[model samples]
Target: MFRFLNIVIISLITSIVSAQGYYDVTKYGIPNDSTFVGKNAIDNIIQKAVQKGGGTIYFPAGKYLTGSIKLESNITIFIDAGAELHFSDDFDNYIPMVPSRWEGTTVINFSPFFYAYKAKNITITGRGLIDGHGRNWWNYSEGFDDKKPKSKWENTFFENNKNVLAPPDSKWLKRGFLRPPFIQPMYCENVLIEGITIQNSPFWTVNPEFCKNVTVRSVTINNPHSPNTDGINPESCSYVHISDCHISVGDDCITIKSGKDEDGRKQAAPAEDYVITNCTMLSGHGGVVIGSEMSGGVRNIAISNCIFDGTDRGIRIKSTRGRGGVVENIRVDNIIMHNIKQQAFVLDTRYAKSTIGPVSERTPIFRNIHISNVTANTKDAVFINGLEEMPIEDVSFSNIHLEAENGFDIHYSKNISLNNVFFSGVKTSLVKIENSSDIDLKYLKLEKSTEEKPWVSAINVDGLFIDGCRPKKGTKTFLQLSGKTTSNIGFGTNDFRNVSQVVVKDYDVKKDAILK
Candidate 1:
């Protein structure tokens, strides 16, 4: 009986402590007025909560203007429905450079708007809005004229600290000065951010770097057509889950990256084990993009049930020769894309200004990717361009239906399989293969356009197999073979309706290169 009473007493004490853990900002002398700078007051309240062994910092219905607010471990910032966290416009407000990575390169620069370092079990959840007030930052970066004199803020800090303002020998300096991201949690674990509206981010929004087990759900990101306003970028992080989000931004909607160039190769941390689902992308460079900065490599990513509307590209994977990394084991299923301006699916090794050189550890590799059940209407069906030295390998597509202006183009790739893939409104050749080998096409259907190109064109190809491929009626040529290096080409059970010629040889080749 005594032990039972002791248990009850301990439970009561725990409940009482939990009830008393709510720290209201108003009670802590943080005014609701929009003019007040609440950074110090808010930090004090967070520290108080941490002293009490973790709690929630509750913001009532008010507009609180603040600078950079650092987050601590085991703390939650909960804003009420009518509350607005407006970040300050003063550039000096984010002083004291912090260790952060800007556009894939690690540097010590300005802190992010909502910064967290090495925090665990941290959450930023509420039905309120976090506004970056990023117009000044954007103008400083985008609208700056070199002939004009600098603004007072710029003259004071940016001119005084050129090293801090720009990355080391970065190409981004030609575009403009660097700006901080909206939210960045570096080396954090068990982070959760949900039910928040983020807008007008100066740079990439919701970037979690070197973090693990991060969850971002039900968040709405709205950034205008400004430069480098990516929606959600998970860099060098593992076990990330992002779902049920609506993203409309200037750059890519979701860009998975590790490091960039030499810095990335040194870090050698891959962004892996990601599950992104149920997201809606309205406008961006690409709906889902991997790299341009993925030198550290990426693997084991799964994206499904996403909708891409009016984006420049639907799904894109891009890297260059110097960004030495390997991206493998990616699975994408059940995606819908409409009115994409570029190719529905693109894998290009020549992404940015990086060029090919002697193949080394810096040469990027992309392989073992599977995409299925995708329907897209775009300007181009698919484009896979790999380097001549290091080719992309082991990619497969199944159950894909695309209506595009141009058909598929494959170059310098190997072991690619397409099953049950259909394309319509192709202005160019139905399928074009160049310098590739070990390709298998089954159940491929093509609805050709008015162009007089061949239905299938192969150049410098080897081990090409076409099974059950059907072209539309009144095609001129069924197959056009070119390049003396072509060999072992096979056509099995194909239907060529009213084709003018079965084969057209563009180059003189050896016998037994083409097989029926």
Candidate 2:
């Protein structure tokens, strides 16, 4: 039944191509052989379509090998069922570099396999295969992100292509073999990528940068353990809707970004107003991630109805100091996760390259986020970390049912509320908190164990409140407070009859800090 439903959805999605006048590639004398390099023929066909005021270029029921395809405005490439659009593995096919962005930095690199720039009303649809033969690209580019390479030099690769590599300061000139994305539509509007299976990506797959009104639906992306092969990365784009996609790649499945540090701040474009729903992810770093590259700020994202299985983390939002971005107004609901290798939910703002300074534009900010209706089985339940200077603010978690090996950890945050949370299999001693304020726990059902453990352990924390929460039967300690700075803790209307003690404190904390 689900398969039939998918068929119906794909048929509906492909309707836009069906309505257009099609120029079949068979009629253009392109080779039918799978090994043929029909780059010129394909380019000529695209030119002809553009000359005729734009039309659908159709490839029907065969394997066609080609290189980079540059799309024009109002053009649609419809690959019919049983058709495979395979990209050539030869590096020479991607010569005469194009303007592109790689990992948040703008550069003139190898042409993306399917690229569109400043285009409007473009689409790639139909039930077909878009394969990037990327094994060779992966091998040649290995061990080069390192500043010092082990092997000797390839001077020609750098000397001949030095001018194309941008920023001059970038390491891309050194690693001249930085592979291109499978599909990247930059600065385009009204873009759609639907009803296709894309695999073997050399780098990111289905990446739409600086584009608006983008929709990627019913697309399946499968990449093996290739380096940096992310799926469905929409960077610096707005009004994006990504739904009904299946992704399993080496890196983050769906990474939302707005570029990185200095360049990102210069671009000053946030990847905001996004809706990601009804997607299934498998064997990736994070199911749905937002930035380690969000210096341009990311906001107003809503993700729902997603299933993540065998991913490293379920929902991850990560950035660091010196990023100079604000990530806020995010909502995540109705997510199911299993076999999460790391934390089920994490919001970390200290990833890499942090420096001590007064709070300014360099300090990344996270605020106004809510996550609810999540069920997960994972190694750790939650990990939330914020900076000391700029704490993460106004975050909420509700209706979460989780079975994790470790307990929750939070630090340097404020205005956090956890409601209707059911947690089990917590092997760690306490739900630890440090250097935070205004934390409220309501209607929580934490697992009870015979081991000596405190329900919550806090240090240097203030404005902590617990309401309508019942402790597991026969728990030893209710609250363990430490540090002389800790104060203003209130046990508000909670059932602690089965617990032994109300407050257990270290030598530094005063008993007057507790209000029961």
Worst 10 residues of 1 by lDDT: 159-168
Number of backbone collisions per candidate: 1, 0
Query: Candidate 1: what lDDT?
Result: 0.87
Q: Report the lDDT of model 1 for residue 17.
A: 58
Work out the TM-score per prediction: 0.92, 0.92
Per-residue CA lDDT of model 2 for 100-156, tens digit only, reads: 888887766688999999999999999999899899888877755555553323343
Task: Tell me the lDDT of model 2 at 203.
Answer: 92
TM-score of candidate 2 on Cα atoms, chains taken together: 0.92
Local accuracy of candidate 1 as per-residue lDDT tens digits, 283-332: 89999999988988999999999999999999999998777999999999
Candidate-wise lDDT, in order = 0.87, 0.87
TM-score of 1: 0.92
- Runs in model 1 deviating more than 4 A are 1-20, 144-169, 173-177, 353-355, 448-451
